[model samples]
Target: MPPVERRDPEPIEAYLFDLDGVLRVWDGADLAAVEARAGLPPGRLGEIAHDLDRYGPALLGEVTDNDWRASVVGALVADGLKPDVAVDVVLDWSANLGRVDPEVTEVVAGIRAAGGQVALVVNSTDRLELDLVVLGLDLAVDTVVSSARTGIALPDAAMYEIAAGILAVPAPRCAYVGPHAELVAGAERIGMTGHLFDGVSGLRAIVETLSAR
Candidate 1:
């Protein structure tokens, strides 16, 4: 692995990661597929994904699968598609999606090689087992906390607490890497080091810097 830039050590002991935009790019492709299948114009998925009312609680684990399905169906219906067809199309789009970033995998490996515990905290409607299998990511991390299982998602302090509890580490010693500023901020609020990961190199640098602290 390439050497990550170093920084003075802080107090971080474990690492928490967000799956979608942070660790992979398949999420965008899935959204595109959903919009295309629903015959909607571009930007629909982006709008929904960024809509705090829609995605916030979903990321925090406050939303249920049924709620997600209903919301998706409603969005497609508003876009002039049939509800059942929308549901099916969304399911298909998500089911076919998988991770595409090898650098992320390498970073996870590097974290493990450094003797850091790694965990996944993601906003997912489907069971993580299917997604992990499709992406071949099951063995890459120490634990996977999906909103589907945790009943809470990012930006919610409870979710971070749950992740810390599961990792057997204190919140202050854990680090969270995510693409969303709000989510990273939330982790920071809970005493976890927050790193906004734009790519593998950036994340590797953050990890190395933290490790050295």
Candidate 2:
């Protein structure tokens, strides 16, 4: 993809960041280790955990995090692993929340330093708060809007709307960074400037633009 340019027509007062791909960086080796211990093929556990039909309710706040994990474990058990072994494997896999990206951290700090607020907007489960605390990101932003907490997820406009409202900023004055094109488009539909987060450099470019304003 080409580099993202600084193209916001209006001054942005706040930034809405996506949690998983934008701020948190996953380590494949950790996953590989967990899969090895479980005698499962690489990516199998993740595939099961992210299966939309099984995970949709969790993200929508209809189920607890424990319920989601239990469902994944049950699926593994049905695939021939002993129930106890499956539970252990799921626990280990779920514990790895991944590390924060320092570059993105710098960008977030820069935005705040420039008088802009930042909110973490995510499609997540009830475990989000715990995971944020574990990753030392609970205080990293001005506010957080989780689908599990709001009972709404992107590309629904309400998620972005709630984040902007929390920051006391108008939707048109907020900028969004996310990996999914659909989510980015959703934010744009609500009048927020949207930057598709293809990489750190693209995000940095957007930050630079916002800072220079």
lDDT, residue 106, candidate 2: 88
Q: Which stretches of candidate 2 lie over 4 Å from their true place?
A: 1-8
Q: What lDDT, from 0 to 1, does candidate 2 have?
A: 0.92
Best-performing candidate as measured by lDDT = 2
Pairs of residues at least 3 apart in sequence or in different chains that clash in candidate 2: none
TM-score of every candidate relative to the true structure: 0.77, 0.92
Winner by TM-score = 2
- Give candidate 2's TM-score: 0.92
* CA lDDT of every candidate: 0.78, 0.92
RMSD of each: 6.5, 5.1
lDDT of 1 by residue, 1-213 (tens): 999998654678789998888766755666676678767777775675457787656555577555765686687677777878877866775465565588888888988998889998887765566767778888889988887677666688988888899989999899999999999999999888899888888887888888887
Looking at model 1, residue 67 earns an lDDT score of 76
Deviation from native of the Cα of residue 49 in model 2, angstroms: 1.3
- Residues 1-213 of candidate 2: C-alpha lDDT, one tens digit per residue: 999887747788999999988999888999899999989998888898899999999999999999999999999998889999998998898878899999999899888887889999999999999999998899889898999999999999999999999999999889999999999999999999999998899999988887676
